[model samples]
Structure formats: structure tokens, C-alpha cells
Target: MPGWLEVVIRSFVSLVILFTVSKIFIRKSFTQVTYFEFVCGIVIGAILALGSINLQIPIAYPIMGLLIWGFIPYFMGWLSIKSETFRNLAYGRGIPIIKDGKVLEDNMKQQRYSSDELLKQLRSKNVFQVADVEFAVLETSGDISVLLKKDYQPVTPKDMGIKVAPIKEPETVIMDGKILDEPLATIGKNRQWLEMELEKIGVAIENVYLGQVDSYGQLTVDLFDDKLKVPSPQQLPLLLANIKKCQADLEAFALQTNNPTAKAMYEKNADEMMVVLEKVEPYLKQ
Candidate 1:
């Protein structure tokens, strides 16, 4: 074989072996990998490169190096799982860098994390002020986990004791102008329903670039034509408005009626409708 042919064959073999090993043994993302794992990756790539290009070196040597480098990490990972002490040693535990809105300089110094670096990480977390963070920990992955003070944190529905409906994942019924039958079925909707929705918006099936059915069962679509504007689904809002109007009419009737019994019935019905509206407002408004 020509020298170039030999190199190509070696590279192809090395690539297949590397890919197989990676799939079978290595699965962690770069950010999640430990220092030891990172070093092993560099060494493995160097060994493969030398093995592919350097014909003078025995192929068996590189193969042995690859096996050793790959299996040691896998074995260590297994051992780490079985033993807490070994796991902590292999993957260091999270260090508390901030407590009670105060920075722990000693811990930062130990980790060689400077003040500027700490501020930069906090800023990345969307926290500009150190005092706003009630507590913060430096994770083993080098990411900072921050907890904002109660006053500084954004208020949620739970905080206000308001009940909100749980949101479900939206189903993609159409993609690239093609109807996805499986996703349509997953959302408990058929092609006919989707077609009707498209028709309501004056859009054709082929003209739809993407279509998704949200948790509220509202079908939203993106069109291929940028200039064509599609109106949002108003079914929920319209239903809510109609219900409110009925409630108002009942109240008005209660005042207008001369008969005492009829007035009381109208007032009772209006009160009941008001309760129903409050219960469903959260879901419909969303």
C-alpha cells in the first residue's frame, strides 16, 4: 500500500475504535467531566493521533494504551458509585462560597477562585449584587448555584397562595409543512381538527412551517410567509368574557325584577357564577 493509503486506513480504524469506546464507556458532558477524566481524554486523543500517523510505532502499543486509558475511568466511575468516600475523592463535593449573604473568602482562596471570577459567575446567574444572594455554593462542575434573598427573589404563585394549573409539554403536530401523525395523536387531535384550525387562520397545511398544540388545547402555527400575520386563538378569552357577561346580566336582572323570589334567585345565580369564574380564571388567562 502507498504511504498515504496506509495512513488513511490507520486513521479509519482508529476513528472506529475511538467512536466505539466513547459510546460504550464515556457519556458525561464536558462540563460534568472531572479533572482526571479531562486529562484521560487529552491523552487518549494524542495516543490515537500518534498511532494513526506514526507508522514506525507498533499498532498494538496504541491499542493497549487506548484500552487502559478508557477502562480505568470506567472502572473508577463504577467504584465511585459503590463507595461514597471514593466518589467524593474522585468528584469533589460542592463548596459553600457564600452563606447568609456573606462571601467565604477562605473557601474561595482554597478553590483558587478570585473575587472577580466569583462576581462574574454571579452575574452569569443574573445576580449583580453579592448581598442579594442568601447562599451560594460552588458545584463540582464549576457552576455556581445561587439562592437569592426572599425579598430579592421573584415572587411565584405559590408565594402568594394562588393556585395555578400545571402546564403540560406542547405537542408538535406539524413540522416543515408535514403533518406528524404520531404527535397529533399524542395531543388527542386529528388531521381534521388541525385543518380546521389552519382554515380559521386563513392558512393552508403546506404553508404552515410549524404547528404546536399547547396545554390549553390551542393550536398555534407559524407560516412560511413572514408577511402574513396569524391571529392568536381567542377561544378561552371569549369563553371567559361570555361567562362574565352572563354573571353581570344575572346581577342586573336581580335589581330589575320586582318579585322578591325572582330577585333572590337571580342574586344567588350571579354569586355562584362569580365563584366559578374565579376558579377558572387562572387556567383561561394562561
Candidate 2:
């Protein structure tokens, strides 16, 4: 084989092999997109490129190098979890940038952040005046986490003495026009119910881009074309929601009450509610 052809073939083959090996060691996360991970990714890419193009370099060396690069940090990550000192050393603790409506110049200097950069971060968080900030911490992820002064903070229901219940994360019912079984099963629902709800809204199953059931059991649907108004039945979601609430109440009551007879009754009633929900699920509006 010609020298040029050998390089070409070797490069292609090496990239594939090295990338496969790298994937075994690397796990991705949102936080991992930070500066450290970005540099780590670039180093791995460079190693793969060198291993692929340079026939002079031993393939085992670059492959091993990639593994070492991956392993050391992984080991450190494990150590960080086990030891607070290691965690603080590897990923420095969040430095206080602002407190009591005053910027901490010393902490900013410690983080090597300039006043301009600090102002930019503050602006990004919608704080124009430093006086408005009660507390701010420069996180290890290079993002500035801020808290506004009590007077500057947005008023909540509690501030006004109004009571409100906590809400759970919204569950996805459908994605890419396909009903999600696992999420539906979570809230005591199934595909049939999803289809029925879609029909009630005059939306074809394929027309929906996404659907979610919120904590209040409200169904929100996003169609492929919003211009095509979907007259989704308000009652269908409401009825299903009521059933879910009833089942939840029964289950909670069963768990809390020590009476075996009452517990059995509650469990049985919850199961019956589930059955009724399934029965009512088939009726879809044309």
C-alpha cells in the first residue's frame, strides 16, 4: 500500500477505535459542559487526531493516554464525592461575590473575575444595580448565582399571606406525536386515554408535537400547527384528573391510617377508581 493511502486508512481506523474507547470512559451531564469538561473533550479529540494521522505514534500509547485522561478525573470525581476536602480542592467552593447589598472585591479577586465581568454576570441575571443584590456567589461552574435583597425580590403568595400548595414536576404525556406510556402509567393513565383526549381536542394523534399533564392534572397540548385550533375536550382531562386525585387520596389515606380494615378498604376503592378511569377512557370526540 502507498504511504499516503496507509495514512488515510490508518487515520480513519484510529479515529473510530479511539472514539469507541473514549465513549466507554466518558459520561455526559449538563454540569460537565463546564470549562473543565470542555478542555478535557478538546484534549481527547487532539489525542484521537494525533493517533489517527501519525503512524509514527504507537496506537496503544494514545489509547492508553485517552484512558488515563478519562480515569484521573473520574477517580477525582469519586474522591470528591467521598471527601469534602478533595471536592473543595478539585472544584473550588463557591466564593461570595456580594453580600448585604455590597460587592465583595476580595472574593472577586480570588476568583480572578474582573469588575466588568462581574457586572456582565449581574446584568445577565437582570440586576442592573449592585445595590439591589443582597447576595451573590461565584460558582465553580463559572456562573454567578445571585439573590436579590428582600425589598428587590418579587413578591410571592406567602409574602401576601396567601396559601398555595406545592406542585410536582410536569409529566410528559406525548412527544413527537407518540403517546409516552411510562409517563402516562405514572399518573394512572395509558395510551387509550391519551388518544381519547387528543380526539376530544379535535386533534389527530399525529398532529400533536408535545403534551404534558401538570401538577394540577391540567393537560397542555402543543400541536404541530398552532393555527389549527384543537378543541380538546376540557371535561376529559378534568375527569381523568379527578380520578387520579381520588386514587391519590385513597392511597395516601391507606398509607397513613394504621387500621388494617380501613387500609384494605382504601386500597380497594383506589383500584376501583383506576378501573372506572380506564372504562371512561375509550370515549373520544370525533
Clashing pairs in 1: none
Best TM-score among the predictions, by candidate number: 1
> Model 2 Cα RMSD, Å?
10.7
In the order shown, the candidates' Cα RMSDs to the true structure are 2.0, 10.7
What tens-digit string does per-residue lDDT give for candidate 2 at 91-203?
87888999998888888787789999999999998899999998899888888999999999999978997545566899998899888888988998777777776666677
Model 2: lDDT of residue 191: 79
Estimate the TM-score of every prediction. Answer: 0.91, 0.69
lDDT of 1 at 77: 93
Off by over 4 Å in 2: 1-38, 231-286
